[model samples]
Target chain A: MTATAAPFRAKRVLPGFTLSLGTTLLYLVLIVLIPIAALILKGAEIGPAAFWAIVSSERAVAAFRITLTAAAIATAFNAAYGLLMAWVLVRHDFPGKRILDALMDVPFALPTAVAGLSLTALFSANGWFGQVLHPAGIPVVYTIWGIALAMAFTSIPFVVRTVQPVLEDLDPSLEQAAETLGATPWQVFTRVVFPAILPAWLAGCTTAFARSLGEFGAIVFIAGNLPFETEIAALLAYIRLEEYDYNGAAAIALVLLGFALVLLIVSNILQSWAARHREATR
Target chain B: MSAPDMIAPGSAATGHGRPARTMGARALIGLAVILTLLIVVAPLVYIFARAFSEGWQVYASNILDPAMLHAIWLTSLVAVIVVPLNIAFGIAAAWAVAKHRFPGRGVLVTMIEIPFSISPIIAGICYLLLYGRQGLLGPWLGEVDLQVMFALPGIVLVTMFVTAPFVAREVLPLMQAQGTAQEEAAVTLGASGWQVFRRVTLPNIRFALLYGAVLCTARAVGEFGGVSVVSGNIRGQTNTLPLHVELLFNDLNAVGAFAAASTLTVIALVALILKAVLEGRRG
Candidate 1:
């Protein structure tokens, strides 16, 4: 607003609302706001009772329960796996280390449909892992374990990625000092190393959780999608669309959007707290 | 460096038992190897095994078929159109948000990432709502005799929406880290905004752009949930490689579907390579 102070601040980047703000608004309108608003407005055509009835149906509830449960378990599993990966990638080197590091993004890069189909083949009754586990009575595909495994597969990178940079930035000198102290190894890890990485770990877990929650494709073929059983909320939404009920699908999707936003917000707080805790400890 | 380096009395030479460093290293390495093998290698081998199961004759037949070619071509067409547009969107948004911290920056950042959080199926629904015959814009579109839902236009738009954030998300952080110093230098020399981007900034962010493009291409090509709602699955017309795979799967052509899917797997593999190269360069 100040003309004299304008150049000093505007000179920093591409200043002036006319350029940066205008472009940012345009981008959001084109990509995010318009599409989402369209979804909501379209859903508004149906009455409130219809919306509620569709989203709260027994089938819908069952799908949500399974989706949330599987996603939670999957994300929790990934948190441990991801942390181990970040630690290994950052700290250790052995035969084929680079190749192993490269393997982390496999799930991210693989097509969801292919990933889904392959997972089904690998875990089906006659499949490789299934052949081994079937005798042991541990089923995978067409069951909850399959859903969790698929979700976990897709979300593997999120947690590892989040913790990786933070780990890379960590100084061994601090750990060395703690070691030189009379503090035991477990004490050093728990009191020092573990605490420092906790925030990033939580952030990564949140991302993995959110991604797992919304996953559809990778789980569809693998999950039998039986109502009140393995059916994920996303599959239920697709079924709604197939049945030509736009409102039903939108209501489920809106619920998903709400949950994602809430989780993201919670994770943001965790992320900031993690950073603040690190600084405070320092 | 401060108090830690001060060296507590007799601490360095203390015989207090420490963790076995080699033990930890070996343990971590073994775990990492096994996990990577289970998570990554095993699935790939399963899929690849199928490709060879039916012999090279069936593989060659599927790969060389006209229908398969068309589906592949359609996917390429979508990628060719979608990737660059998203790149433009990404670069513009990243430029605006990352270098310049404007009001509502948090809001803008969140807005950009909506596609990332929202279900792709929802992305498809969003398109259906926007351009479907009963949609808000339906009347306007009808006037021009433009049909989007279940058409090529709709497929491309949804792909754009789904992949909206890849390039922008990649570039923004890197740009923010780089600061605006170089671009400001270009501007001081009277480079126009476009010139600043083309000459100064573009070169620096090329790797990010490539990374984002690879991600965008993968998403666009493999897109099912979003595209399914808009495309009527018109085989040889609207059917993408992913759709073909699904359609073939539904038709009980397991071999056809898997064969079609293998092509996508190969594309995804390229995407994997691109990501690794870009990330390695970044690190």
Candidate 2:
């Protein structure tokens, strides 16, 4: 502790601790923290009763239900599609595989507004996909299904990207041993392969679900945005803000923020658990 | 371990020449290809198709419209300003969190990721609450006569928030895995902090940095919900490309909307190509 002995930081090898950490902290506080704090402070100013009143309104309730349900449907679809994609990309070899892999990232790279517009066009009565489905008496535009489709489109990559590496690293000998033990392919997957990828799969789904929950640009175009139906919580918040009801907007936003925070925490926990599980198996 | 692991997934008893297994593999691949075509490829093709629905002349006219040009310029302006600032933030955050251990290191990592979870629309609302006319800082901002909301600054700030994590997320894992040994060696050899980073660290993380920058640029240019909230949606002023597309669509100009959207679609394609190239190089 003596000055002559040098302080702990002084003896440390890496320099720029203060400089680097300071920059990080200053940016986070200015760009990230303060703005979020404004929202929280606004929520606080509204008080508990008023906030509850706004969030519990029937329209608000409907928006929440729709967002959650559509997100759930999107996540479910991604779970199956993503797993299959991951498995195929890692386990099979085929021509154009590389191109297909790159295609998987289109949702992430594409602008949400663009995605919404194209999806709306494709599903409209006169559009390509719509022309076929419309005659079959199945309409997609301005419905919850369309909302789910948009969510699915934007979040398609989350599960595939997360699970691909894990599947790639899976030990073949373990599957071989299961096969030698008189196990069918189904049993091998269920008993050995599925267990191994389960944690990563779940982590991916959680993130996909979170992404779907926050989706806005894409859904608005396709959802038809009818109140109490296709309108999502994010759009509802925007609507509140547009009408100059800051309190109402803040209330709905606070709830959405809470859900996001919870999901983020859950996803982080699941990811770490997956990492530890991988380490254990290795 | 590494060599076997690389071969294991592809070489495993996955297909085994069994008819049932071979059929299963083909079926799964077919399903994946078809689903991807429908879900991902269709919309992409549709963007271009609808963009040129009225022929290339109309598409060209839509893209060349003064309002469309302004939106493009504003979007580019935001991306130009936001990307460099975010890259710096990303480097500093990654350097701090990876090169050194601190009490709240984990918490800092989590905070950096806060934007990803929160809706971009919420981010816009947050800024509006902070800087809008009746916002928390509105009075003081008025006293100072500085406008944040409904201006370029608001658009840039919200875009920055939405994209802040991209570079750091890309660079951090690589930094952590590479360890601090090389940096420590550089320090012992009388190199300054900046020298060590520039000489030793920069080369190591350059690909990841580029990957992150590409992703950040795409996100910044395409950011809708947050920018929409703050930009005030003034035609030919605060409007971005995404917002312009929406405006055109709302005005019953679907062809113009798709034409505007097609430009973004090309950007997205370029980003995906760059990402794939970088991924291969990094590996």
Candidate 3:
């Protein structure tokens, strides 16, 4: 057959749009949108007072405070600690450097429950690290400190993973330029390098913060899950579900979802800023 | 560190910084390593401590217990299905987004990240609403004898939702970095589109695909919230190891929960090792 020339030809300017779009729609329809829509539909069944009373109870309020506060504290710790880890991994080399770098991913790979247990084992009164800290009068396990520890364990990798790539992309000459202009090392880091990666650092911190708020498997072992004390939001939801309180569970979940969505907005802004920085340097 | 074949040839020399001009850099690195050791290394040792506390006999018994074995088997089953299915989804999504400039490409990408951002428990509730006895699809599923929630299908579905983005996220970046040159070349050489994808595109993205699968499987195995919410956490039936840990914890078998958790952690350690080695190779 001879090739026919037409005034308008469908040249397929974008590669594989039809095929990819088909698959994406299928996946999202089956996996995400449908399920989430289900959740909204279910919540629509409950009365407003029932939703409020279950979620707003003193015990539930206490759980929310415990979970949200611990998550914030953990995220703040990672913001500082993860940046330091990222700085070391990105900027320095020593013996077993690769091993140390590998260690950063432990939080990502390790299950939360195991992380909690291991942390507990090390910090319990009878454990190795606990024995050292006992005389110093620091209690870790069976407390909010343990909850924070679990969150920190799971949250560390988020900040490190996010910040590591940004740091690697950061040009050092800018910092040198700052240093040569009479900035001290601390001043150079704070004023120059830190500012550049701050958005990404904030993005990572928010992700960690959101994750710790929802984290359950790891914290359960260490948190002691005491109502109005060590109990967290997710654990409260679990307890509500255990008591067959579906409305209560949904209300708490909706609250967590609200927080997660807010954090998402913040991270989205930070991500775009990161992208702009990359483009400018490129 | 000296694995010559894996890393880009001579990247060390190029990427390596000059020796620290000041002592501050030295101390900072030193301090970071110590903290990392304190945080990461010490706890991992304790996982071994909990597992091997009573030595070989105890470890053998704890590990060989039927419940632990079942948890491992169930987790494996979840991983087996979740990884392959997600890989397919990832490839499809990545291919579409990377290869196309659609009207909703940005929206679609954002949608893909919903799984990662939303709590898994919320995901479970989503399915419960859609397919539970009182769910929207409940009548339809009942008419057809299909059970979506409180079953294995529910577990698989939620896990899939949670991990759906991993491979696509990994492959999309690599594909974007490489652009469409090779595929175009393959088509020019009389290769069919399918042939081009299989022989050229597949090989190029294989490493990212595997990397994504590893991450996906690790997550699927560790999944608790989504699975727990949908699964009903039935012991010996619906209990994945994470669920089992919670069950034991509730039962006041703290040691048993720790033991079960160690099993998952050990798997995580192996996976983490594999991931690092693979990433090291890729870098």
Per-residue CA lDDT of model 1 for B92-153, tens digit only, reads: 78887777754577877777877777778888888787888877788999999998888889
| Candidate 2: regions farther than 4 A off | A1-7, B1-21
DockQ for every model, please: 0.44, 0.53, 0.44
Count of clashes, each model: 0, 0, 1
Sorted on TM-score, highest at the top, how do the candidates line up?
Answer: 2, 3, 1
Clashing pairs in 3: A112-A218
At residue B171, what lDDT does model 1 achieve? 80
lDDT leader: 2
The model with the greater TM-score, 1 or 2, is: 2
For candidate 3, give the lDDT. 0.77
Give me the displacement of residue B53 in model 1, in angstroms. 1.0
Tens digits of per-residue lDDT, candidate 1, A168-280, equal: 65667788899998788678878878888888788888878888888887888789889899999888888887888878888888888788878878777776776676566
Q: How high is the DockQ of candidate 2?
A: 0.53
| lDDT per residue as tens, model 2, A101-213 | 77887887899999999999899999999999999988999999999999999988888877777776677788899999999979998999889888888888988898899
lDDT per residue as tens, model 3, A85-108: 778777776666677767777787
What lDDT does each candidate get?
0.78, 0.88, 0.77
Error of 2 at B269 (Å): 0.8
Superior by lDDT: candidate 1 or candidate 3: 1
Worst 10 residues of 2 chain B by lDDT: B1-10
